[model samples]
Target: MDLDDDILYEDDSGNESSENGDDQFMEMNMEPESSSSQKRDEVDDFQFEILTPDKIVSHMVDCIKEVNAVVEIPATTTRILLNHFRWDKEKLMERYYDGDQDKLFTEAHVISPHRSIVSKPKKTTRQTAAASSAEVTCEICFLSLPSKGLTGLECGHKFCTLCWTEYLTTKIMDEGMGQTISCAAHKCDILVDDATVMSLIRDPRVKLKYQHLITNSFVECNRLMRWCPAPDCGNAVKVAYSDAKPALCSCGHRFCFACGENWHEPVRCVWLKKWIRKCDDDSETSNWIAANTKECPKCRITIEKDGGCNHMICKNQNCKADFCWVCLGPWEPHGSSWYNCNRFDEDDAKKARDNQELSRSMLQRYLFYCNRYMNHMQSLKFEHKLYASIKVKMEEMQQHNMSWIEVQFLHKAVDVLCQCRQTLMFTYVFAFYLKKNNQSIIFEDNQKDLENSTETLSEFLERDITSELLVDIKQKVQDKYRYCESRRKVLLDHVYEGYDKDWWEYIDI
Candidate 1:
């Protein structure tokens, strides 16, 4: 019988049967027979078809080629393709044949061996190709750079370190980035991050160059500069050279040691002093002899001695009249010359009498101003007392749990009264200064009129029972009080705003 067909004939003790039955009988002889023996014998006797190694290899090769042909596959997918080719080749050979199949498997697993190979030479070639593709050149400095050396900002523009650092340093020095530092590139708003700077400065030599540009070439103040030490003076003090001692502030005021102004004893350097005298007239003289040189006390004009013995002549056109060198009086020849007389003594006496009269007139004016200032202060004290009384009453009313609307109305009233009182007080203070100094009385009289008007309006509001009347009174008081306040601010501004620089220098604390 055919191997694919069932067996037909069998013999056992003259009995006829199929070969399958005979085979089963023979299998029963090989082991302990069991109830499942019939099923086991049928299974052992069956024939089935199996795929050969060549056919499996061919299928795997076709699958790999199809996957590789697809464009833009991800790296993971590409890795899967390589792994499948390797795994299927080994699996096929294990199941069908156990001999070496290196050449057959190699041909099936890889396509274009030069391109798909993962050897060292192939990897090196790929890296070289990537480097060449990514190389860029700086636009500003026109320097060629390797792809890795280039840095891209948020704007997506790449720049070399040298050009970017120079640009940033200029911007920081000139237009200080007080709150924010934005990109220097035109129309680009990217803010520079600190990491970008650190990354670009990998080369030590390039980093040193960048630092020099930042510290030296930039116009920013050096660390040695300090704020002025004068109390309430917000000016900055800077010196050109750190090693050189700075000159003192001309106002004769001292500052902290770090403020670049320190007092030191003046040293006598002959040549230097002479040169300074030519350049600056205020240079202090060297010795007692130099100090005694005749200089006009009023104008400090130097008088040269010429054509006279033991006497100086005043050649100044304004003071050409004769004067004594000792006393600066009208020059009277000491030796009983033609000009010697007691008439000089009589002239001096008359001048002293005139000075006494002038002093009396000045005293009278000062006393009158002082009395006016005292009267103004008294009026202010009266207004202050009235305001304090009203404030206390308002506070008491608030603590009694009044309606919010009523409380708010009372608060507004109290606020208006307090503000009116402040305006009056400030005006009084300003008037007091003007009066005490015997200066112009116009400002004082004007302030006094405003005070009276404000006080009357405030009193009217307090006495008025109707809310409408009180509102009207409040509006009037605010208008009048605000006018006075504005005037006071103007006056104070004039007095304090443009103070002399020397005035600030004298602040001790």
Candidate 2:
């Protein structure tokens, strides 16, 4: 039965055509779904609002041209466009439709605008106040209303923006009052301390409103001068003419000439002496001066008078006194000559005298040591030259007398002479090395060892007996044996002792 059914289906051409048509329909439907999923993923990843109706319509036209397929616009994008234009389908289509397919394929997509995304203007309380205060008149020029404009400072003082700007720019540019731009009102020199002027000028509208004020024209008046802002004080302050520093008033008020807050104190004027003197009484002044007094060489404690000579008077409360020029001690009445006032102590005087004697002794010892060392070095050098000459003569003798026995004997003698010369060299070298190493005792001991070794060798060589001569010759040959035996003795004792005594005496001083 199954074989018969297959044979019937194969024979029917309509059945094959129907199956192929169904497969084509499925592929057509799946293509759009896959393409739309890809586009939606791309749009989701972007941060900007680039998926507007206009941009979508522009992209759709390009997609249609590139694919040459009936591209259905994304449902998300279609809904967004519909909502933006109040669901007006015809208007959305008209706005987004691309007329030329070739052009759409070449150009980039455009973004559509939404009514909800429009930017709104900013407003602040200070700006609102400034606008309302535009009706107020400037005291300097006596001008009123919107023609001159208004500038509201942080201190809440309002002025014509033109007048304030002109005054500030001129003072800063021409007169070099570049730091301050205070209010122009009489006795109201509050500063305009705004931190956003750079940003405020970025707006074209604000810049246009205050253009004249920014130029060089306005002049700062005395009205800009203010009392020091110090608490409980009512001192009037002025800007220093020579320096930019602020002058303080008697009431302790501090204001800069540029109309900024008190940055620092100004130099005291010479004319303020009388005013300062009038502030306190005689006894009060005397006490005040004493408390603030400086000790003088001619007098003792005296009040400093500004703009006067260095000469002073003693104003001690107990003794209103005078003293001599040379000495700084108290003097008898009408005494013109100097008096010796230095008190002497027994121990201190003794120490001073001892120090002087010690210094002299040290100098004498240093000179003696220096002379001794120089003479010793000269003697060593002379001895070394003499020994070297003797060595050359010994070498010549060995060369002239060629008998084997005699040569052997002369070689032995040369060896002894070489040993003696080496001893001398080692003594000098060891002395220098010990001095450098601060081991003068060891160096001196080595020198004494060399001297003893030389004396013993000389005595052994001078002995008359043949056996003694042979023993001396053998001893001279055995350098290592002699060295081992002599190693335990005080070699450089004398040199070290002398050096130690000299060094200690010099250092003690």
Candidate 3:
């Protein structure tokens, strides 16, 4: 099967479901065995609902209505308050009820209609003349216009409708602001409401862009939500709570909701972020240089002795200090010798060699883990080919008188293999930063067992199959993949256990 068209989904219960239809890949009991474990396992059933742009907008409206029902405020103002609180209704309620009402509205950049009214300021001659003539001066355009031509927020900072359109358009299109677009009046912190934006902006393209910006802001600010990181995918996953857990998007992309990277378990978001930065940086290049190159003792300028004699001289024009490449000692001290320097056995020379070797060892250690990490990453990139090959195998098995459901084991095997590879890939990342200890040794052992089984399963799947040996191959493939799956779970369980027991220790990069 083309796995792209039939993407697999795993719910909180660990039962697998394919999006193409009701065909389940696997089913297993998820009930906790004891009451003590029930609480922990309950989190396994954590629910989330995937939302489209329209649904997200509807949800935002519902939230505004819900809060408005209790607070009895205008729906427009409620939206601003909800956004200010990052759509956290409970926290908004707590602050609204337990704190100063005027202060809350002030912070949210809105004038509270419920606030006590103050004495009105005396009108200027121009204001009186405008009031009498039913015309007002627009501060932005400096043009006198009819009172109906101007608009303003509750803060009473008014501007012409044309100026409002230009200002809102500039903010929405240029600055990419939606929910936080403040008033056009100078020094005015009052926000422009969605109703005002819709009423003023008539262009459909700008309106759609505004709506998109609003939806983006809603999802980005909400703690329980995240936009699927897949390219061109507009779906957002809204969860019951925030966590560093794996989330599969409707577009068939699986990623960690916390940091929006590929679903990397065993390793964490912080370490993965650090590792990515390390990989992107020239830190390893510097390490290689430190390990392979020698610096001049007199001027501390780095030099790489690619060839020639040991009587090395500093390349610096001002500080041409002569030194021996073998011991890095003064050339005068090795006058009787060419390649040999007696200072090679000296304390300073030994320390210098030891430091270089230490750097070399550190680089080698990083490469040991990095190479494996990169190998699995490259393998993962070509997993689609594996899936296509398995589809062919399934067809071959069916031609040998096997039923459709009977050949699903091939798909299951490939699924398990991919899962193992993914987990194994991140295990190397986890191991890279892990401090050596008994627990880490055990973790490494588990990693090795899983890796060996995964490679064996991969080999079995990639081997050519004949109709004569289909029966025997089917049994072996199933058994090997099952073993791989179990091993993967075992490794993950041990890592989770290490986390729970505080058995894992980490080293700073």
Best candidate, lDDT-wise? 3
Candidate with more favorable, higher TM-score: 1 or 2: 1
lDDT of 3: 0.79
The better candidate by TM-score, 1 or 3, is 3
lDDT of 2 by residue, 97-161 (tens): 65543232222121222213557677698887776665767655678866336655434455665
Number of backbone clashes in candidate 2: 12
Question: What TM-score fits each model?
Answer: 0.24, 0.20, 0.84
On TM-score, the candidate that comes out on top is 3
| Residue 506 lDDT (model 1) | 14
Model 2 is weakest, by summed lDDT over 10 consecutive residues, at: 1-10
lDDT of each: 0.40, 0.38, 0.79
lDDT of 3 at 232: 97
lDDT tens digits by residue: candidate 3, 1-509: 11112111112323333231212210111111222211112236655667655456556656765787798776667778998999999999999998698899899998887977789999999987777679789999999988877898877888898899899889889989988898898888888876677667755456667767877888999999999999999888878788888777667888887899999998999999999998899999999998889888899999998787888888799999987887877888776767666545778877887888999999998999999999998987776578888898889889889999999998998888888889989999999999999999989899999999988988888888778877788899889998998888899999999999999889888
lDDT digits (tens) for residues 1-509 of candidate 1:
11111111111224332333233321222233232211111121322111122222222233333444442332222223334343342343352234544343333332222234445644587778787667688877778887666566645677777777666555545554311334555665554543344343333333333332322211123333343444554333333333323323223233332323322111112322333343244322222223344554335576544544534456676765555444444555445542443434555434543544555544444345435534544654564465556555546555655444553444454454554444444333233223233223444554555556655555654563333444554466556556545654544343343232212111110
